[model samples]
Target chain A: MSEQEFTIEALKQILLESAGADENIDLDGDILDTDFEALGYESLALLETGGRIEREYGISLDDDIFTDHRTPRALVAAVNACIKDTVTA
Target chain B: MSARTVITGIGVATPNGLGVDGFWAATRVGKNAIGRVTHFDPTPYPSQLAGEISDFVAEDLLPSRLLPQTDRMTRLALVAADCAFKDAGIQPGDIPEFDMGVVTASTAGGFEFGQNELKKLWSQGSEYVSAYQSFAWFYAVNSGQISIRNGMRGPSGVVVSDHAGGLDAIAQARRQIRKGSKLIFSGGFDATDLHLGLGRSDRRGRLSTSSDPDRAYLPFDAAADGYVPGEGGALITLEDEQTARERGAQNIYGEIAGYGSTFDPKPGTGREPGLRRAIEVALADAGVEADQVDVVFADAAGTPQLDREEADASSAVFGPSGVPVTAPKTMTGRLYSGAAPVYVVSAVLAIREGLIPPTTNVELSPEYAIDLVTGQPRPAPVRTALVLARSYGGFNSAVVVRAAD
Candidate 1:
């Protein structure tokens, strides 16, 4: 699949895996609208997840991505943009 | 009646093992966990061997959020606390939040973390240093994080009283429980890997420079020279007797009968009477006599002078016959502030199993008329145990633990 095809579901899975099985996170509904703190994630978790996404997508992201784009959908879009930039370059 | 404090759960990240069962099995057979240092290059230092928790991967054990905020020492402490909580069958929200507390100890907190952050500031820029670096290196970080993570909002504190701080932390835990806190997670862990602190502090010529793991830390032996530094920690669940019984906690390890601390008036100022006094006070506070102590977990400082002082102190307490002494730390190098808690865990296990784990890599010195248990595990009715620890700067602490009556 192309970098543009990266789905919000994929990002949701990453967030769930990062949070661990014990955490009470809802994956099916409005994951993009959910606050990371609501999912038992803190700033460090967001930073770590950002790092993992960067590695997985073969791209680099700004340190402020978590602050600027605070949801899974927004993070996925940012990740996609980075991946597309890498591919085009 | 005083609020009786008991160890209901034990969690340890030692060089020997991870949890209570693994630690007990390793200690039972006198397994050696010290090896050549792998965390950092040891060529520049005098000591080559260290009892490091090489297998631990903090990311795998802890929550993702804790990864950035924790140093290796804090990770070890949190993991041990996790194990202790699990072993006690208690979860974060299981009990009343205000009734639970934490009391931990550390000598060198996050030495490696602070060192790395300083390196970033030196080479890159001040902006490159992570924000978490500020609190991550503090000695009280473990207690604070453990409390925050577990929702334990009761009276929480940290002890910074050298290596004996581990025992002192436990002593403080008992006091907290008596003063109203129903449960407390108390122990100690230390890491000296990156040399921001401990490496420079060993200038007193006390650390062992031996390259061989087997001969590196032969405490109480005639050939004893110095001790190998180690890294790790152990935390135990200290609960009120009524609280534990109410929760149906079946595995009661032992009770903290009494604890005492003394200070040697700065080395050479006087005969090191602090250790002797600490032991005596602990026994008296426990309402126990020296004869009632089934086993003695000795400090076993390994240095010729310190070992002699400890031996003299033990002899002074136990008299001519002498109590059976063992230093299981031969299996894992002295973990600085963490040393005493693991020894406390060992004592509790010894009391439960009715056996004294042998002190490995030692030949009993003829000069010291102490029955140092060596070679193999000794079967004994260990109804009570006396554990001892002393810090570098004249501080000494002792605790008397008794099997549940």
Candidate 2:
């Protein structure tokens, strides 16, 4: 799979696993537009997700990544961009 | 007047089990979780065996945000606290922000994390140090992080009285609830089997070097030599009776009926008065007679001398061969600051299920003449339990828990 696809899949799996308490949000829905808060993820959960992504991909994310990308789709895109920039450099 | 404090919910991340149900099930059947150390290569250490929680995956347990900033110890604490809050049916947003509190006990705060950071600093450079290096090992970090994560804004504190602090944390929770806090998260946990932590245990000369898992921690046994290091912790929700009633909190485990603590500075004697006195005081505080206690959850220090002291103390308080005694720590090993709360959990389970969990990895030592429940679970009406704990460095504590009314 392409890096983007992998990132998207990874993000979805992480959300699906962590978002057990919230029954309102559909896990199969478009993750890009889904607000994580609506899915029962507060700041702590989001930060933990970011940390896992950083460790798995071997990348250091900007501290403000949560502010920059509030949804899983945006987070995956940002991560893919980070990997691309690192590879190109 | 102090409010009546009762344990409304319990959560545990033990080597034997991850939650209260699993933990109780394993304890009920006398399942031991000790094994060859997998957290690190055990070849260099004196003890090759430990009660390690190898199956816990932090990312799967906690939020992604907490993964980088916390250590295994804190992760265990947070997960246990989360379970406890769910068990209590409490939502921080639903209650008054200042009505809840968090109190935890710890002997070594994030020792594994601190050890790695220090290695990086020495082997690489100052620049290699992680930003979390400073806060990771602070003993109070567990209480602080739990409060922050749950947005609990009431009184918070951490007890550092070695393993004995586990019982003390619960005592403090009752005190807090009496002082007007509606609910308090109380108990203790530790993950200190890293090289640094292990080296300290090695220097103390109390860790069992036995590579065999079954023989690793034989508390109250004739062959008992020393304890094997264990990791994990327990956290329970203690709520004021009125608050629990008001919130419609069902599933009450038991009440923190009474507590007492004493210290013994002189270490050489095989007999100690402090443990006995603590038990006596605790029973008196609860207004219960010695014969009324259904079972005594021993400290089960596993050292030959310490085990003798604990047995003698029980004998002194409850008469010879008194009130079915058990030490389920033989199953989970001693988890330092996490030990007593886990014992408290076992006692509560015994009370709830009316069966005393057996003491595994032990042959009744003829030396102490104590009637230890072993081999299999003993069925009896368990109404009250007295849990005991003693720190290696002289702190002795006892807490009395009774079936919730």
Taking chain A by itself, what TM-score does each prediction score?
0.80, 0.79
| Ten-residue stretch with the least lDDT total in model 1 chain B | B193-202
DockQ of every candidate: 0.12, 0.07
- For each candidate, give its TM-score against the true structure: 0.86, 0.83
Q: Which candidate leads the pack in TM-score?
A: 1
| C-alpha lDDT of all candidate models, in order | 0.84, 0.84
**In candidate 2 chain B, what residue range of length 10 has the lowest lDDT sum?**
B125-134
| Backbone-clash count (model 1) | 0
Superposed model 2: Cα runs more than 4 Å off: A1-89, B267-272
- Tens digits of per-residue lDDT, candidate 1, B3-40, equal 68999988898888888998899998899998988876
lDDT of 1: 0.84
Residue-wise C-alpha lDDT for candidate 2, range A1-58, written one tens digit per residue: 2343336667877654433335455667665677778666777666656765675566
Cα lDDT of model 2 by residue, B1-405, tens digit: 456788988889889998988888888999989898888787888887888897899878786556656889999999999999888888777778798889999998888888888898899765456556657778999999999889999999999998899999999988999888888999998998777777898999988888889988898888888998889989999988877888789778888899999998575574445888999989998889999999999888888878888888888888889778998888877899999999888888899899999999788988876779988989999999999999977999999999987
Query: Which pairs clash in the backbone of model 1?
Result: none
RMSD of each predicted structure: 4.6, 5.6
